[model samples]
Target: MDASDGHADREWRLIREEAWPGPMNMALDEIAAETAAAGGPRTLRVYRWEPRTLSLGYHQDPDTVDWDHCEREGVGVTRRPTGGGGIYHDSHGDVSYTIVAPADELPGDLVESYHELCAPILDAFERMGVPARFAETERPARHQPACYLRELHPAHDVVVETDGEERKVSGNAQHRRTDAVVQHGSLTYAVNAERHLAVFADASVTPAAFRERVTGIADHADVSRSEAVGALEAALADWADATEGSWTGDELERARDRASEKYASDEWTRRRPGRR
Candidate 1:
């Protein structure tokens, strides 16, 4: 289906406002993808991280993580199934989302697929009165270890122009398998630079530098985190023509099992993608 089509022509399941630990969040997304691949309903969900969390990209170097700092600060750590640099998801400072459907149902080209899936994200920003769009040009990386600070690409990076410069507000990536695709991302509603930086092993990235490279919904719009979440949830639902929904008991059980086996396991988190 064309992503720009009105809700009258499409259907999806909407899961909103759930909060879970990092490992469970990742597992749930995986389960959602599996469900879609198995002829189940497509999903659009917005969720939060409890205790905040630092999520490493699928291929991100484990050595770039500051394990001691994360433990000391009570920040949970997990690895995403998608690829990108690390992202620090704050409990109240960020919003997270996932979209899952059969791979054949979306665009065939990778970048085009991102554009199609990210339509609701741009609409969400519009609903919150933030003028955000996909970046039109590439920007050099300010820091390679962080998703927001890495090189900006027009493919999936969302930005708002401020003071004549485009500052990143969101980063998204996709994990495509033979039968399905799962697209997930983090959008900043507020910045916690100190905590964000402390998750990385690099100590040279100052908060001022981070502020220059990244931005949040609160930066350009006077919207609270709760307000932002509401707008985003509404946007995703409208975009997908989705109905209010919840996980089935079996799905939740499967996600819990997957979390224990993969996301929460040291063998899965500490090694590179294929190693585990």
Candidate 2:
């Protein structure tokens, strides 16, 4: 894909798809990244899961999550290529976004890349009149286990102050492939903290120990779903020309095939033995 002016062509494609299973969603993102690299289009997708699901980080141990509990609770479990802790996704609490672009379209380094990608989220929150800023520190506090638990540098994260209390509202993760970079994250509007605690509370994780490590947007920013989406749209519009659309037949088919072959396999999901 050549931009006449030596800059990436500012094209944004937005997709809203019906709730899909975990592997399928991951596959679609991989496919989108490849498509974008081919100069097809820079794409953003918003999707959900039919049944609630738990997604673990690429290198995270599946055992870290209580699979017995998830299975009993009817929540599906899948792994993501990105590095981060696990996340629980429910209908009302979750909003996920995926950005697919050529490397040149982003920053020169990983840290800078995160900032460029995360700007829209910060802008969105600001548009909502929320005073959000990125955390300046790179070191994690003693008890912080997940990315969201501690603020890291260069990540386009959302931090806000309400009632004189500071908190984080959103966090993101990225996966850089040979062809392009795919960054995806969730803006947690609400969280079932108790449910998450219940699932994590076990011999491995104590309820009191993990409670201080997780948070949601509802904890700081008081905005409705429509408001949040609108803010995001406005913010994204400032950076690129967003075109609302759906996945093409070819893209969907490729994603489906990849999901079955790679994302659904235990070899890929449980790559490390004696871990899960």
lDDT of each candidate versus the true structure: 0.90, 0.69
Query: Looking at candidate 2, what is the lDDT of residue 221?
Result: 64
Which stretches of model 2 miss by more than 4 angstroms?
Answer: 1-8, 138-147, 150-156, 162-165, 201-214, 220-222, 273-276
Tens digits of per-residue lDDT for model 1, 1-276: 355663335558999889999999999999998888888888999999997889999988889999999999899999998888999997888899999988888888999899989999999999999999999879999889899999999999999988988899999999998898999999999988887898999979999999998999998898888999999999998888889999999999999999999998888788764664
Q: How far is candidate 1 from the true structure (C-alpha RMSD, Å)?
A: 1.8
lDDT score, residue 125, model 2? 74
- Superposed by TM-score, candidate 2 places the C-alpha of residue 121 at a distance from the truth, in angstroms, of 1.0
Displacement of residue 86 (Cα, Å) in model 2 is 1.1
TM-score of 1: 0.96
Best by lDDT: 1
Model 1 stretches astray by more than 4 angstroms: 1-10, 273-276
